[model samples]
Target: MNFVSTRGNVSKIGFIDTVLMGLANDGGLLIPEKVPQIPAERLQAMSELSYQELAYEIFSYYVDGEIPDNELKELIEKSYATFRHPEVTPVQKVKDNLYLLELFHGPTFAFKDIALQFLGNLYSYVSKKTGETIHILGATSGDTGASAIEGVRGKEGIRICILHPHGKVSKVQELQMTTIHDPNVLNLAIKGTFDDGQRIIKELFADVEFKNKYHLRAINSINFVRILAQTVYYFYAYFQVAKETNTKTVNFSVPTGNFGDIFAGYLAKKMGLPVGKLIVATNENNILEDFIKDGVYKPGEFKSTYSPSMDIQVASNFERYLYYLLGENSEAVTDLMNQFKSEGKIVVNEEQLLQVKKDFAAHGVLGEECLQTIKKYYSETTYLLDPHTACGVAAYEECNEANDFCITLATAHPAKFNESIERCDINQTYPIEISQLFDKPQYLEVVEADNDEIVRKLEKLFSFSTR
Candidate 1:
């Protein structure tokens, strides 16, 4: 499966090249030229396979020719071996017709681990094979910075610099990223919001000369590999829910920030998975919710809520979805994106809005409402939710009218956001792995959100010379 840019200017490239090259050279996110379809027989056959097996099956479509079959299988197996759970991502029945797809069993205790672990190893594998030094850079809200750091901490020849919003993320989230002292990892808490960091990351990547000089690669969901890796769980979760309930279809409620996770679900649906309506759950920063519920996509003032991760006005991955929404016409995608950048919003036509509404549902949950959902779930089902997942749970409850069971992605462990949990009068026994994080000395540099200032810091921080 060859990949092309959403802007449609870049030449077609294979999977390995796509993995190594994060953002497209033409300043657009990468997408497969074609999405592979899975027939019903294949879906039934896949349900019986283990998580790793399912991953290999789903990943093989895009990843077939570049990486050898045996090597890819081994790589996927090695990545999941770090997870604490036997099932890398398991499902918990919270109540009848409602479930939590637990996705926090990895090294850093967040869903980002599912993709980063594999991406990190893939980088190392490629670096070893090609004898090239690989430098990675990206911005994160909370969980992604830590998970990306955890993915490549002491791995040789792979250096990553992560930019996060200073003082905006939860304390545990901050500690998770800032405490890592690996020379290969540089954590910068930028003096702005997640949207600022995201913008900075995109701006830096847009400079083709600078990007090529540094051999820069993105670790963000803008990296199509991460989004592709993320789609496996949607298939796995759908298979599990369908088999258990004897239903033909199942819905997923994903708490979204940059629209990455839910976009993965959208890909799964396109790939012929019986994925019912994908609920795009958001916190106070609800640009995605607004876009889905209404035809207009406008960025409001960014609000920091209980779920800091979703405190993003600009959803970077939204551009990829827009490509498909515009009939995969790269010219139209380019035009709309240019308009969005210049005017700060994009509105869809009635037919385009109708098409999107067919595959997705969206809602914005409030801080107090999130807290109440956490309280209610913990009090009733004894299942604790991080603020992000609480937002998903609330949305799932609000949007569901189907008979089939719905799975809400439990994106991060509850312990990662104790500040939100505390407001619900809930006391959580911190995981032994997590409790040790507070004891570590943090290593981070505070920086302004300016792209040039970051470029200077990154040049100084990186140990290797440019290729």
Candidate 2:
């Protein structure tokens, strides 16, 4: 259960420390020192268990009793209690050989809630054990901010600061993060792209003294716990399909910007889920799509698309995948990332590129294609998809070469993107949780990308909020 930095320099650590020390000191993503493998029969045995049970079984491979079993179970129960659906994430057949795994059943109505809720509870446990407060710093394009806020809002011994790209997210997405009045939740609408905000967080974390002084932690998928929580759903979706349809193999199409969601699917495949293809779906900001399809990792202008959440040119979690793709050679990953940072691009060797293509297929859907997918799917199956989910569906339809059935991860509720839904001549009645967000007064600060100014503001805000 020990974890190591992807750069191969940092010392090995356990799960809890990895969770706390987000980005590795060596400027690499943390990955399990040894990825636990399961046999197909063992994975199938997990099908009969409930989501909570499945999660417990999967986490056992990572936690290794870091948190006592009973306490972990309690946290899991508390985290999932807020989900509106009996199945935290339900799988529905949208068409023949095409399914949608609905993941927006939690309080924040985004896939992130599943992980953030667990993380929030975990933080409470950690704070009590160490008798120290933690400051959570994260950059979100859309859903992560709201979900992370909801996770730690009003919780004791923790203060969360979320940075989001101002005016780049959907109205509901922005409102979800901005309207929260929790004194412990500090929302910053940065006057830059999500990549800028993300870069700021990484820069701050890379500063050893500054990171230690503030006890900075992460809620992004960069945190291994978030990725672990997300892995459960892939198993859940696979088992759910196995139970009813008896499908042996399934392909997952995940609309991802940060690479966390699909990376979870990749983990499931590595852990021996009969995953045929892990489809990396993207909007106009298709750095991931281009990189996976080709061997070149190049940065481009961050395009604001209908799917604002996917409007990211840089995918942070890609490093973790590179750890696996490069034969677990951390030095190679470190060199590649350093090159990408300095040159704004990195080209992989043919062998490395071939390895990437074997496990994952990537495609980018344009804004118009996303909108049309939403309208077309609604017309055919009466299934309303958010722009992000629409991109997933469109990618699957356009680039699917697998013979197995497809399961597109519906990352968010359509109600969260009402304007995009309306573009398809549809009106959505949001749930009471979302509808009430409009009535709440927003409390967010605007800041530039300067690290010192942002840190100063955080210090001032922390003092004010704590007092």
Top candidate, metric lDDT: 1
lDDT per residue, candidate 1, 272-342, as tens digits?
99888899999989888888978789999989899988899998899999999999999999999899889
List candidate 1 segments past 4 Å from native.
463-467
Worst 10 residues of 2 by lDDT: 458-467
User: For candidate 2, lDDT tens digit of each residue in 167-246?
Assistant: 98888999999988877888989999999999999999999888898888988888889999999999999988877778
Model 1 poorest ten-residue lDDT run: 458-467
Question: In order, what is each prediction's RMSD in angstroms?
Answer: 1.2, 1.2
Return the TM-score for candidate 1, rounded to 2 decimals: 0.98
Position 45, candidate 2: lDDT? 84
Model 2 off-target regions past 4 Å?
464-467
Residue 232, model 1: lDDT of 92
